[model samples]
Target: MGELKLSTKIGYGMGDLAGNLLFQMTVIYLLFFYTDVLGISAMAAGIIFLIARLWDAVNDPVMGLLMDRTRSKHGKARVYLLYGSLPLGLATIAMFYAPDLPMGGKVAYAAGTYILWGMLFTLVNIPYSSLTASLTDIPQERTDLSSIRMIFMLIGVIIVSVATEPLVSSFATPSRGYFSVTAIFSLLALFFFLLCFRLTGKAASESRKKDESYKLGEIWPLLLKNRQLLIVTAASLIGNMAVFIRETSAIYYVTYNMGDSGMLPFFLGIVVLSMLAANLMIPLATKKWDKKGTYLIGSAIGVAGSVIFHFIPYDQTALIFLFGALSSFGIAAISTVGWAMIPDTIEYGELVTGKRAEGISYAVYSFSQKLATAVAGITVASVLQWSGYAANIPVQSDQTLRGILSTLTVIPVIFIVLSMGIIRLYAIDRTTYEGILLKLKEKMS
Candidate 1:
């Protein structure tokens, strides 16, 4: 396969930039928004998250199968990108909108909108992710694509982390502010998705012509037998869990443990910028130590940072940012490498089964991500409630503060460690992948 044009790579990256604008906002603030702004109990909000993600267990695979079978002038995956972008943007706006209703009504509304958002997100994201394999088969280009995607993803994260609060505060009410900011983001997301659709037209058509279709029932056996896919999926899940746990609990940590809610944007900015810095290092790091080795190194760095962050005194705000950035930097490597690794698995699976199911492969991977988000949401909410958290409070009990600190620091370290162990079982190094690709090409010819 030939190298993709720089324009095409960047246009592809824009899809993720669009995705993270809404996604990071939800990861960082939605729970806070539910408990603090909307007056829903933490437990209730957590349950809503769980319910929505559980539905994705079914939704993700179905969408994947649909994409695998789709035939269109626009191509299988890109068709969804063209059509689903607008609905997805609208769903994001709905997710942030605060309805005026009783607690029951509020929970119901949150659940309904959130579920709708997740479904739409799956509709677009599964196809978008699957598009990577369709774009190229070269490992270096895949890594480049993942790196560019992460850079854009982090930029979106920075925008949400740094700007959301100020934007919210600019409005008469927090609710109105969230709604308006989300609307602006939604419009921007729409434009970017469309741009991506336009720029990647050639690659999408190529992917459709080359891809082999498989039956729906084949998904399970293919998934069950693909050991590399299973390992990477598990690792990705745990890594995402660590990320979302820290992200979800960060506001509480800044608000109660540090006694300064105002510094959230600054704190989050430091973390994301550090992640971006790490993302920039990925191509270099992969050269030094292939993807698996690079991933382990990054996880170790994250573990060290998390441990240090846990032990530091809350009053040492500078130290907090320092270690937090360290952890985030490591996390960026894990995320970028993990994504690049997934596309390689498509060929690996095909070599084993004589089948190529990019949509199902990415769908299962996407479902793991959603599951991680759900688990993080519920875990944080339940922990907070158990710690005697009460919203809109000037002060929290020592136990509550400690709970917040642990969720932000210690718990994530545990998840990251587990992810490190899981990834060790993934046997697809550069040599193995190259061999697999060679065999796949032989079989196809």
Candidate 2:
């Protein structure tokens, strides 16, 4: 494979842009959608989140195995991006569209539609992520690709964060507003998918082996042997709990704790801006401290900011925003390097087993991430339910407000710290990765 052109890089980045169009909604608003809009109880919403995403997590590896065996003219990974877009897009709309049904029926609909969306998402997401490993073997190129990809993802996050509340308010009712906004986003998602499909040509297919033969049963052994992958997976699982839970709780924080649901967009926008700035700074941070060191620094900052925010009064809106931005920026610093780390594990796998199972490698990573979200979703919902959160209430009780605060701050701080410790087990560094690549090239020659 030759060097990737600027156009190809943008094309690759667009795929994530498409996925995040729907994903950011789920991360930040899905539970709220189920509870407030669809009239599900908080506990019920938590159960729904748990069941849907656990199934989604379990199903990821199955899709990964199928992708490993896939032989298609359109290309293994890219073909899914082309074909899976419409179904995924439709499911996104359906997840947000609440039907006028009885409580049980609505609960069933939420679970079914959410699960379908997750399935379609895995079909597109695993392939899109695996494509990075195939796009280039150069570590620096992978870094560039990861950075570019995250920048686009942050753009999607920003668009959704800044627009969702205003769009909802623009409609006569919140339900109608959510449906309309998601419908538009779904179309944009499809277009981005098509563009990504067209862009994944020879460059993204570089890692595709002509004579690759691997059984699905071997995936477990591959995962067990790849120590770097395990370390990355564990670290991500812990870290994502903090990220997903904090995101899930932010709207609730702004609404109940800060006394204004109208301010949701403003708070989300600040976080998005912080994330964007952090993404831009990742390359410099990595250069100075390396990925592990940079991630630790970020985690420490996040933990500190989250802890401080918990103690401060919510009436201090300016201080709240400042702490929120600082915490988010730290989280973004850890996330910017996530995709880059997975590709390096591809080389690690090849060296260990003489097979480059990028699909399965990324699947494990994706699976862990989705599983973390499931846990966080369930945890957040359970907390709100236990904490006495009542939907459509003008003001929550002191217990509910306190629970929301813990959800936003203490829970995430603990998880972020745990992840920082877990990352210490990861063995791969620039020196180690370069050595592995050099050895692999020698073997190929």
Candidate 3:
């Protein structure tokens, strides 16, 4: 790792808004789109998302492996950003506008294109994820960079969350209008990805071997022993599951639970507000408490909100939104700082093991994220089904309604608490991290 310049870190922050907005659309709405708009059954939608995510899980590691071996004057990861953005957008559009065929046809088409999109996304993401660590060796600087990225990411998420359904609903023809609206929003997402790609250059990257290729066997042991990576990975996996549930369940909670579908934006607006608030305090939080403490505090916020949600009676929109906003604020801490930590953990990995297995470390990290998302999709879908949630039905039974409610409240709460406790066990305080960095710098020099 080289010395980090604050200006470079700020530059990277500029790239996040468009990149995240593109990612959030798929994460938040794909399931809902499949189950309701595309006319797929909820159980079937669950199975499809699970299967697709499983493919994503498998592909992430492989892409991570490939990215390490890639060579270019633009550096290892930037070229993918240059080339992958447009097709990624096209795939997004295709997924929504998939030919209206038989049920199996729709599923097959979705799986094929979505799998490709997932792989492409990984192509962009692994390098993107690995970039923070590669950019600098300083923990505080990394936190600053991460915080900036989170702000832009929130901006992106807010735009999509606030605009997507509302813009679509305004169209006179509901069904076709939805597809067109998604396509346009998706294309705009691509524009942002491209802008992000163009904005970031290889200046922050040090010259490393284009020819040096790493084997998985060597990479695995290094990741296992590189304790910081392990800590962040554990935290990231569960933290991601919590995030996935929040994203995918927003529609359900707003439409069904709150009985005010139009208020979805209002709620999502609160989420954006929380994110904005969190970002404002991030540098102070990280400087004062370090990454581990920040993570724990944020996780606790999520847990408290979830518990509050469970105990509250129906129609407490204010309370539900309040808690949801708080939970999202906590989440902003994780999102901003958590990603920064993964790359920093790579530095920790290099420090302990003398191996710059960025690709392999990031690959497994990538794999873990996909794996968590896969499990999340399966878990949520299965839970929804077991709880008797049925899509396209006019009415639901008490059991089914209770099941849906539980999915929105209890499951996320449990997942968040478990993730928080795990983060508490993470041993990367500021002093420990600085010690590691000092030793690594000594060794490299």
**Which numbered prediction scores highest in lDDT against the true structure?**
1
Off by over 4 Å in 3: 1-7, 172-175, 205-212, 393-395
User: Per-residue lDDT for 1-445 in model 1, tens only?
Assistant: 5689888999999999988888887899999999988899999999999899889988999899999888888888889889999999999999888889998999999999999999999999999888789999888889989999999999899899998999999999999999999999889889988888888888767652555577777789999888899999999899989998999999999988889989999999999999999988998889899899999999999988888899999899999999999998888777899899999888888888877888889999999988998899999998999999999897999999988988978888889999999999988878999899788778878
- Using TM-score, give the best candidate's number: 1
Residue 129 of candidate 2: its Cα lDDT? 90
Worst-scoring 10-residue span by lDDT in model 3: 203-212
- lDDT, candidate 2, 1-445, per-residue tens: 5478999999999999999998998888888888899999888877877787768656887888888878898778889998999999999999999899999999999989988988898988999998888888777777778888989998899888889888888999989999999999999999998998888775765654744478867888978988888888888888989998998888899988999888888888898888888878887888788788878888888888888888889899899999999999888766767777888887897899888887888888887777777877898898988998899897999999999999889899889988989898877789999899899889898
lDDT of each residue in 1-445, candidate 3, tens digit only: 4555555655566556646656677777777777777776667766666677777656766777777788777778777777777777777677776467899888887677667767777777777767676676667777777787888778877888898888878877545765786677666766766665555565445633433356755656777798777877777787788777777777776776666778888888898888788988988987778877887787778777777777766588888788878877776666667676776676676677777777777777776666666666666677667877777564566676666667666877777777777777677777777788789668757
Model 1 CA lDDT for position 347: 85
Taking all chains together, each candidate's TM-score versus the true structure is 0.98, 0.97, 0.92
User: Given candidate 2, what's the lDDT at residue 221?
Assistant: 90
Candidate 3: Cα lDDT at 116: 77
